[model samples]
Target: MKKNTLFVFALFIFYFSFCLTTVAQTRSREDYEKLGHVVWEVDTKEKIVAITFDDGPHPVFTPQILYILAKYNAKATFFVAGNKVKRFPSVLERIAKEGHEIANHTYNHIINRNITSSTLHSELEQTDEIIQSIIGYKPTLYRPVGGMHNDLIINTAVKNGKLVILWSWHLDAEDWKNPAASQISRHITKGIRPGNIVLLHDWIGTEYSRTSQTVKGLETTLRFLYQNGYECVTVSELLFRSEIIDQDYFNTFPIE
Candidate 1:
């Protein structure tokens, strides 16, 4: 009887997990926009793309990524964690000095979905304070760690005066896994469109140094954009070029 019951419980858990995945896969971008001031991509026709990096300010990889950006004359956004900022202030300073957008990714890189409101607020506030101390201003953008968020996360971020920035659903380079540079570059350059935000990582924590692969991939991706006549700009620049401030601006377009 005990064995039979355990089998049933396992089946129940599997079913529940499958249902969650199905719902996430089926939800359209329009559905996500209804949640809050969330931005996945800018609605525009200009030949521009926003290349954004997350979990950065690494002393080694961040500078390498910056060097490549400079070589290509491209501007990208960097979403940094507070703990990292404290550890690497000079790297953070260089990111700002090099003319890239610096946004918050939380204090400790927390990704718990059931995080309490107070904890979430502290995470954001602490990161904001750290970033402002270095950059002289609080960032207007916040990306939840692991790209996971909910109503509470969205509401809290909005209350704190930030737009929850996410990448184009199709532009995730998945470099954290240490994929080859060629695969990373192709995933971004293929089917590339205007106002698309490309997600890359300049830091993947001390456990691994996968960003070494990312440094190679970035140059190839930038070269493809340059040759294709696409300007690589910051996320804020992309938003301004699209002129989309209203939260409902996404509703005007058909679901992709």
Candidate 2:
């Protein structure tokens, strides 16, 4: 009788542990699917990656970067701030004209979590308006400021017909802090992988003359990706190639 009771208790503990683990895994998968964000890498058996530049449409750096991308015949995504769009409308047109995808990076580039739903919607909607006015089409993609996203922001974005894009890899160039271009490039090259979304900035400090180092680093990074057989593409193409569901998963949420 004593042995049987002990055996039952041990089985019960094991079963409970298994159930918890199963629940956790299920929740993780559900979260990944609903977010529509890149959570895990897909084994496509081909070397491909997406390069994205955010907080841009700057007067000096943006044009130079576009020139390089055009010269290489490479396509990338630019998440432009709405205020910047208003400041440099021509740059926005140039980006669309070059065949690269333009995505919303919000109006003021503020932390979404700190803002109310109405404020968040305004940020996104105004940006979309600015982008559409310039590009003649509404952008379908968005990247939250600083890659900081939450349930509220994601829901708001989905309701407004935007897909929240997050990077699988980051360059951490800290261009805002004036980090060296070589250091940024080295970080990216050392950490480069298939299906990676390499992050860089076309916007820099007021005192900076030109992003010559970033341009040089971009050249080096592109050459390395090419040599490694990785085909750089836009974010949408990457997601489509990976077969992410098109239907909005957070549609039930309110837009504003």
Candidate 3:
């Protein structure tokens, strides 16, 4: 009886230690991201990356992007705004029909910093409804405007069964700034690597500069990625993860 009791106590201690380790890693491990609040990038060595656009369904730029993507046979993820999707459901349908991923970018591209729970949920649901109405389903990825998020946004989004996403700060093309096309292309193509998620824009924003520059940058960026044999995939495909194990430090999840 004494020996059996000792064995049971040992097993309990091992289990307790394991749990503690897991909890610690979850809180403090920048090395591992198994998808909760946000997945900035994926933990993989594959020579693939995701090219994502946000805040759009632009009548002009979206079609141009689609043509470019089709030319390369590349699949991209688009985080579309609800109002814009409502305005251009046919474009969203074309995006889906072309085998691109249509994700949620909220209703109006509002900042996620102090929005109420009800507002957040409403935005998400309304956007989702618009997307579903067009594409027959909604995407699981949720990216807030400007890559901003707080606990409220994360928790609310997770509760709604969606994963929050961000992109590499360095990989952002800054197309929204209406920079020169060559500058945007050079900024992205410099030192590109596997598992990088590049944030771009397809929104026209009432100016030809934004649309024209983004399209030009995209054409150059795609050519660069193609010449180097890099496959531009969807964000969900880039983040193809497996179960976490003992000791591995993947350069994903760049959260502070």
Candidate 4:
């Protein structure tokens, strides 16, 4: 009788531990769904990545950047700030005219954590209005400043009929602080993978001289990605890949 009681207690403990582990795994999956950011990482297999430029449409740098992209037959996504668009309407038009995808980076580039709902809405709406006025259509994608967003931000964007675009990898070029061109290039070459959304800036100040270094680095980075079988694409294309992944996940799970 004593032996049977001890055996039962041990089995109970083991069952409880298994239950806990299962619950933890389920919770992790739920958390990942909630975050819903970084739909893919660039790798050799998928052979596609996105180069995204933020905080732009400045007078000096944007044109030069566009020129370089055109030279390379590369298309990129530009998440322009609303204030900058208002200040440089022609620049925004030129970006749209040049065949690059334009996205919202908010009217003021407000950090989601520090902003209220009304403020967030205002930022998005005002920027959308300005961009639509310039481009004749509002962008359906919004990338929050610094790629920092919460549930509220995502929900707000969805309600406004926009998708929140977040990056999968960061090069940390720190162009604002003037990191060396070699350093920036190295970071990108080493970090790039398939399905990656790389964050870069086209404008740092009024001069736009910083872009010269970035452009040089881009040449090297592009060569590396191309050699490794990675194709550069726009944000819309990358998002489409992510949607396919989501559908696969749902099909596999088949939630009942």
Candidate 5:
């Protein structure tokens, strides 16, 4: 009887694991479709660009980034993590106080794509609340960790009133790898054009040497945008160009 009970327990574990995996994957294909359709870039003829930093509000690195942006008189968006904001409310305060946009990057920077429903729901709310507490307003933009999201995650966020933000593939700076700042500057400014959204990481969770390198590269990048006559604006402002008057924010228009 003991052996039979043990066998049943193992079977139950297998069944539960299978169900979880299936649920996670079932919405994934639909999620991929919706994800591709979401705003990857905006249509505008203005010489303006959007610079977005993800996974940030780091106590040290974030302040460094803010200094560079302020020096150049540029405006950009920060997609901050909830837990990070909780620990570094002052950093978020400085971001808002300085006139930069703060958006949601999730409460915990979960890289795993197979997140449970409860975890996804909690992540959205926790981060939103933390940001609201710090900035006095909830964010309307959400960028998933590493740009990974399924149908459930997208629908949940949209239902909760967030327009998912995804960057163009050709425009990523990939500073998370800690390459020389010169390399990062080139990746972003090379062939950079209007209405293009460039991705960079401000907070990589640890205050590493390479992370500092990304910060170092930021000045050169802002300089490029400044000299090139491209106005560095928040992702929301990028959509606010004359052709698209007003904050056409969280627009459901997909890639044509």
Candidate 6:
């Protein structure tokens, strides 16, 4: 009888914890917007969007992505890893030279949950130093590794003078999974809204072909946006261009 009772109690505890996690993950974007440091997407009516790339500065893919951006006359934000920056300093310089924004993606791309506060600070500091060395200034924006964060991460990042940047919930192209270029392009273009922050990856591991697909997919999406009279700008541009009033309620909430 006691064994059965303990099993039932265990199940109840598991179910209760699941419910709490669900609630935490489902908080509205407005709730986050009010926090001043978390910005997933800006509220605006202009025909512009922020196309951001992460895990990049690859010797080959970075230049390809840069050429495409130059061809379309679009600016983007590159959230590059510090370790990659050390290996490809020139590529990082080119990203800065091209008038794109360079944000920090941590030193080793360690996710927030896996690291302690001290480790997180070290990651940010090391990345900041490398980026500053290459770009002549430190980055003000920081995207948590894997888009995962907690109160400790957020508070620590704020203390370090970084704003936590994330992508629009509907705008992730999921190009890392090596989807068809057409599908990836269509997904981004369809979800393109004013002030939308689109997420893409330039260096997706050693899978050379996968990153190539992202390049191809981005080309198609850029062509569509260029021809459709949409200006693709960096994340900072999107934020500044928008007249976001603190009291205004954003219609959609991005997943936490």
* CA-lDDT, candidates in order: 0.84, 0.75, 0.79, 0.71, 0.79, 0.83
- Residue-level error in angstroms, candidate 5, position 207: 4.3
- Writing each residue's lDDT as its tens digit, candidate 4 over 35-118 gives 453232423357677888888877877887777677666778999999989899999899888888999899987764545557
lDDT of 3 by residue, 1-256 (tens): 9999999999999999986664312232243243445677665677788899999888888999999999998999999999988887788889999999989999978884767778888999999988888777877789988876665666677766677778887888777888999999999999578888889999957625334798988889899999999898987767663222212323223333
Tell me how far the alpha carbon of residue 35 in candidate 5 is from the true structure, in angstroms, after superposition: 9.3
- lDDT (Cα) of model 1: 0.84
Candidate 1 regions with alpha-carbon error over 4 angstroms: 1-28, 34-36, 205-211, 246-256
Please list the residue runs of candidate 4 whose C-alpha ends up more than 4 Å from where it truly belongs after superposition.
1-44, 207-212, 245-256
Order of candidate numbers by TM-score, starting with the best:
6, 1, 5, 3, 2, 4
- Per-prediction RMSD in angstroms? 6.0, 10.0, 12.4, 10.6, 4.4, 5.7
* lDDT (Cα, tens digit) per residue for candidate 2, span 133-221: 88899888888888766566666677787777777645455555556667767788888777777778788764256644676678777
Name the weakest run of 10 consecutive residues (lDDT summed) in model 5: 24-33
Ranking by lDDT: 1, 6, 5, 3, 2, 4
As for TM-score, the candidate ahead, 4 or 6, is 6
Q: Total clashing residue pairs per candidate?
A: 0, 0, 0, 7, 1, 0
Instruction: Write down the lDDT that model 4 would get.
Output: 0.71
- Per-residue lDDT for 1-256 in model 1, tens only? 9999999999999999987764423244577676436789877889999999999788889999999999999999999989989999999999899999999899999978767668988999999998888889999888988888666676677777788899898989788888998999999889589989989988865724544888898888888999889899998888877886654443342223
Q: In candidate 6, which residue ranges exceed 4 Å CA deviation?
A: 1-28, 207-211, 244-256
